[model samples]
Target: MPSTEAPTTHDLQATARRVRRDIIRMTAAAQSGHPAGSLSCTDLLVAVYFGGILRHDPANPFWPERDRFVFSKGHATPAYYAVLAEAGYFPTDELLTFRTLGSRLQGHTVMGNPPGVEMSAGALGMGLSFSLGLALAARMDRAPHRVYCMLSDGDCNEGQTWEAAMASAHHRVDNLTAIVDYNHIQNDGFSDYTRYSGDGDRDRVGGWVLDSGYTVKGAHPGAGRGGPQGAGRLMVRAKGLDSSLRSE
Candidate 1:
């Protein structure tokens, strides 16, 4: 194992800023990309890559024992690619090739086109299933690796998301972790999937619905609704795995 340890939250926060700046520059160059979604998840990505929470190595992208990160919320490639580049998965300059023809970086993520992208994300909700497969494989192989998939609130609109959730829960896939990025706003303007506590459904973000969109309490909400009201109540629940956060 490498002797490197995780960076402090402060340093990770700094790296996140650079990642955000990269998102701004990359999206501007692409001229057609999701900036809001990408910007919203910058710190979360940094927390994983540089926070030392995840075990991975950009130098050895295919290392079997390395942790896996599936960018399920692939539209956020600006942030994802920026993280990968900063993580040393590829050269930072390659980021400039974001969406041009023949460029490895597509508008959405493609597995083989880039060293860090684990799955080819095009549709809204396939990441959970794909990640479940990796987690199951790791279990069967007894490999000490974890697979983390990023999901989005928009993904909940798809039935496949539920199917994958059921499957993950059934198999007890502990190695898999899903993070949802519920910005309360999707391409369609606003996401109406809200969690109802006792009083009723909140029409706005609150509780666990953090400003950054990550669930506060626990990751159960396949729906990714938090009350901004606080992460404790009014949440979506995706059972099993390391819990569900916002979409990738």
Candidate 2:
């Protein structure tokens, strides 16, 4: 098992590099996979898994008290798989088998087969809703687990995401938190900013829910595609959110 101690900055640096390398190698071996988003989210995930922001056990993936993470931006399995492997959830060698016919590491995550995957993510915009359900369920059962969902700018554009966000607020679901990989680039090309702002209201925060009383927006103007700089900035913001939420 990997050490339970929180990794030092140097440790996180090395692990992030290795995870990025794994993402590249895995996608190259498969000859077809999404690497950009995977690369973009490397530091965010590294912080979550290695920075002591998540409660989990590779040996007991189904531990009742383990925190649940849903990769709403499911197509970015390259990052997810690499993080899982480096965290000791699975052997790193299996990363090269990604997207292969018999590999458990498919283009998108499938829950049961993969040791750490918490959701069967493929369709966009549904992860937050699922996470809300999990968080609500834990509240009902008085469970101590927290639910996290990682989304993309594309996922946020979906109507289901809005509804789920609204519902989460209405129900006072404090155990759930979501992070968006708003890298601006989707499968096709750059995302439409108008769509994100909902009818040209660029300042509007998706009109999620005013009653929730919790909102965070971190915008790094030129960091979106600036390699490590972009990833690092986003990672820092995400790490802060995860840390603050954990305290609550």
Question: How high is each candidate's TM-score?
Answer: 0.78, 0.79
Q: Scored by CA lDDT, what does every candidate get?
A: 0.67, 0.69
Model 2 misplaced regions, further than 4 Å: 1-3, 192-248
Question: For residues 82-143, could you state the per-residue lDDT of candidate 1 as single tens digits?
Answer: 99899888899999899999899999989966886889996888987888788788878998
Judge candidate 1 at residue 81 and give its lDDT: 92
Pairs of colliding residues, candidate 2: none
Model 2 lDDT per residue over 10-107, tens place: 67767878998999998888899899989877766786777766778888988888888888888999999999988888898888999998889889
Least well predicted 10-residue stretch by lDDT in candidate 2 = 227-236
